[model samples]
Target: MDYIQPFNRILLVGCNECVTVCSAGGRKEVGLLSSALQSAFLSAGKSIDIKEHTLERQCDPEYVEELVGMMDGVDAVVSMACGCGVQEVARRYKNKPVFPAVNTKFMGASERQGVWAERCQGCGNCLLGITGGICPIARCSKQLMNGPCGGSTNGKCEISKEVDCAWQLIWDRLKMLGQEERYLDIIPAKDWRTAGGGGPRKIVREDLAG
Candidate 1:
């Protein structure tokens, strides 16, 4: 991500809303990134100035507008928000370059207190009705739409013992819900063309637009 721009006065901006809820891009993360960048620059004897700021919500235009005046002295900004927030910042400040500090993982729920696992692939077509509500695309290592490969043993995936096979979870869930017959149906291969295309994607809802 750093290869996108050459920054001198870098502003590490974080968000206090969704990013904070996901425990990724928050005030603490901003401070940590600022300190780390400062240390790296100092060690290389490079005179780069870095600052930190946390917005209530980076995606909101009102909150992002406040950054316009503050960006006067900065050369570039490293936003710690999701891809949506990064694009929002870039859209607001078209003259300046904005880089993403954190990798946008996915839209999913947290498995444990601090462990968030991805459950959706945003394939544009959802097949949870037949898969017992478990997403094989995100959970399975191979993203197999069908049952677990011969690699699953003792409920763990062949790729790693620590990871649970998605099919295993689906089977268990179906049995618990008394809907094991759902797995009998076969699902076809997902079309990658509808997902991410060769370039950027866009969605326009004429009715939703004012």
Candidate 2:
């Protein structure tokens, strides 16, 4: 990459968490990236020593500390995990330059064999109970909580025909559950302060601490 300037040796670290399940930065992906980097460096008339290792979960400090044994002669690190994994690695090893190889997409679920779709936005307030289990905040393009937007036509969103109208799904599910009356109730506006809008979020559980 343009960022890995003049690299003689680099460590390719992979995460076996969400990235592994998504087939982005698992063990197999780490090997493939290592080979690709080796080929690129060789083609440029400069051989590179690539050390590949896949951590169980790079987001955890216990797993990130495993990189201590692999740091020798490593000019830089190429993290094939999500943004969280990359940041953890950078935080643990502040002296080394960590570069990301994969773009962190979203907090999503696997739709099918190889497809993943966004499911939750981690909003502090959850209204799935009233919305009939569908998250309008994430599924709806407009994030409307009251009712279906004027752009909804034939159960599909105006943004795209392929995208379903979240409100319509909620309505249909509520009707099936014999709770359509709940749809008539007005939902309060969201207080984004509890969400990331306030700042970087952190949870401290005094009960769990020793």
Candidate 3:
């Protein structure tokens, strides 16, 4: 509310992707936010116009271009999506201000009902094939690649008792698959080039973009 309080005419955009599945930034969420904003403004004795729209995907220019017509009618955009969607909206609307309603969280998987756990750092290179499908970078507190650190106790990470040791899971999985020898083989340090150490990443598919 504080970020967008200045804008009288707001464009509330929602994404129907990861955020929707997580129940943070979907059509229903958009509606809820819109209602909340309306109620707040009404209580303040001020009226605001908020137009709601949910795109199939917000990161792509094709989906974002749908707003080209609507942009002229709105004052600013409040994107209920990951940072990527907010950035894309900002990129498309250079004249209008774009605000993010959701804090961008790490790439993760749903642990259970309303629970999500970080699962990938997107290092550009995946090592899941050797680690028994478990990501050490995301699961390990220290991001140890070779094996479990000295603090691993009873298959629990040193960071917390509830968290399972990633390397311990890997070793157990390798043993189950009769590939215990793989754990003995040490993994080398990760090259940070693919992990966005150099700069921002881009993927252009000539087959589609062309």
Across 1-210, the per-residue lDDT of candidate 1 in tens digits comes to 254236788888999987888878999988887887777777877767887899999998999997877799998889999988899999999988889998997888888899887888777777787788888988999999879999999999999998999999999999999988888877887887667753566779999967
* Runs of candidate 2 exceeding 4 Å displacement: none
TM-score of candidate 2 on Cα atoms, chains taken together:
0.96
Best by lDDT, which number?
A: 3
Ranking by lDDT: 3, 2, 1
Model 3 misplaced stretches (Cα beyond 4 Å): 206-209
All predictions: root-mean-square deviation over Cα? Answer: 2.8, 1.2, 1.3
When summed lDDT is taken over every stretch of 10 residues in candidate 2, the lowest stretch is 1-10
User: Over the stretch 85-178, how does candidate 2's per-residue lDDT look in tens digits?
Assistant: 9999999999999999999978898989998888899988788988999999999999998998899999999999988999999999999999
- Which order, best to worst by TM-score? 2, 3, 1
Q: Kindly report the root-mean-square deviation of model 1 from the true structure over all alpha carbons.
A: 2.8
Cα lDDT of all candidates, in order?
A: 0.85, 0.91, 0.93
Error of 2 at 65 (Å): 0.6
Q: Please tell me which model should have the higher TM-score, number 2 or number 3.
A: 2
Please state the error at residue 5 of candidate 2 in Å.
Answer: 3.0
- Residue 145 Cα positional deviation in candidate 3, in Å, after optimal superposition: 0.9
TM-score of each: 0.83, 0.96, 0.95
Per TM-score, the best of the predicted structures is 2
